[model samples]
Target: MTTVGFLYPGHFAEDEFPRMEVILDTTIRLVVNRTEPGEDDRRPDTLRTLGEPERLAAGVEELRRAGVESVVWASTGGSFVYGWEGAHGQTTALARAAGLPASSASLGFVQAVRALGAARVAVAATYPEEIARLFSEFLAAAGIDVVATHSGGVTTAAEAAAWGPDRLKELAVAADRPEADAVLLPDTALHTTAHICDLEELLAKPVLTANQVTVFEALRLARRRTWAPQLGTLFAAREAPPAPVGWRPAGE
Candidate 1:
């Protein structure tokens, strides 16, 4: 089985890893963020505080130990909350520290869009307005055009994670724009693998969600481009293999 990993940055609302495994019908290894001594509450602010390069590097190290073929920093805002440059460095540190292929949910979003040949996308964010705005900026930096965006003003990961498939469908349609080539739901806390195709059928456009793209990016990084179609159009993509990046062990 192809095993994937994620550096989860907060207390998740759902047991997301196992769900992805069931839907994708594969193995998913995960490393949740641990609080240091005297660490603050497990909230959005805490996720940001814990998103430092060294701290994230440590988490990736653990995922490597778990035998993850590929891993992603599976927190949307944590990956992009610091902006494009910072997130880039965070994934770079993860690759170097884990000596495994690494990607972030935020970076995965950008790459996913390009892979889908989508230039214009509408964003459905669970973050408050401020954090949602930063995601727009990060996408812009990646050269993807944001045709429209919406923020639900959600305050925490647990809250976003608690949303069921119905809510996920509602959010994606609400965020869709007539001009957008696709709709993006940028929250790793959310569970969308179950409803990705349903959302796409409703919107008649590609619907990319955090968990789906994170897995896709991990599979790509780990040399598992050949995937089954049940995950979503993102996985059903039968294009030629993405150019492979060289893999090196940590501490090279």
Candidate 2:
């Protein structure tokens, strides 16, 4: 079995990892290590602290012991709040600390967008508009265009975790634009594994959720793929292409 480690920020929605293990092919397994919950706020300052190198390093020992082939910082807000360059540095430091291939949910979204050959996407974010705008900027830096964005104005991870499938579908539908090739839900705190297929069908296009892309990125780093149609289009594909040469976050 191939194992992908995730350094999740808190208790919220970490259960999605285990749920994915059950839904995905038996050859792939997920090991999640919850890091310190610095604060529940989604503000940029709080998120920067949540994704700091020290906190990510503190969780590496557990994933290392689990024998994970790759590690990912699984919090979308935590990583994206730092901007593209800072997010790259975050994963680079985590890789050095864990001695394994490393990535984050923010970078995963960019990779997933490219993997699908999508140039423009719409964002359904659970963060406030200011923070959601930062995610758009991050995507822009990575060459993905954000055609539309619908911020849910939810300020805390705990609140976002409480959202259900109906709410998720509404957010996606509201954010989708005809020009966008796909819709992206960029909050790992939101539970989406169970509703990926449903959302994609509702939008009539590819729907990439934070937890889904996070796992995809980890597997890409490990040079592995699992056939899990229930996980959405990203996992249903035959294979995930390796990041392009000189990609800012090179795989180990």
Maximum-TM-score candidate? 2
Deviating ranges (above 4 Å) for candidate 1? 25-47, 240-252
What is the number of backbone collisions in each predicted candidate, taken in the order shown?
A: 1, 0
Cα lDDT of model 2 by residue, 74-156, tens digit: 98888988888999999999999999999999999998999977878999998999999999999999988899989999999
Task: Please give, for residues 199-230, the per-residue lDDT of candidate 1 as tens digits.
Answer: 87787777788877877788778777655455
Q: Tell me the alpha-carbon RMSD of every candidate.
A: 7.5, 5.6
| TM of each candidate vs. truth | 0.84, 0.94
- Candidate 2 residues lying further than 4 Å off, grouped into runs, are 240-252
**Whole-model lDDT, model 2:** 0.88
Estimate every model's Cα lDDT from 0 to 1. Answer: 0.73, 0.88
User: Residue 146's C-alpha lDDT in candidate 2?
Assistant: 91
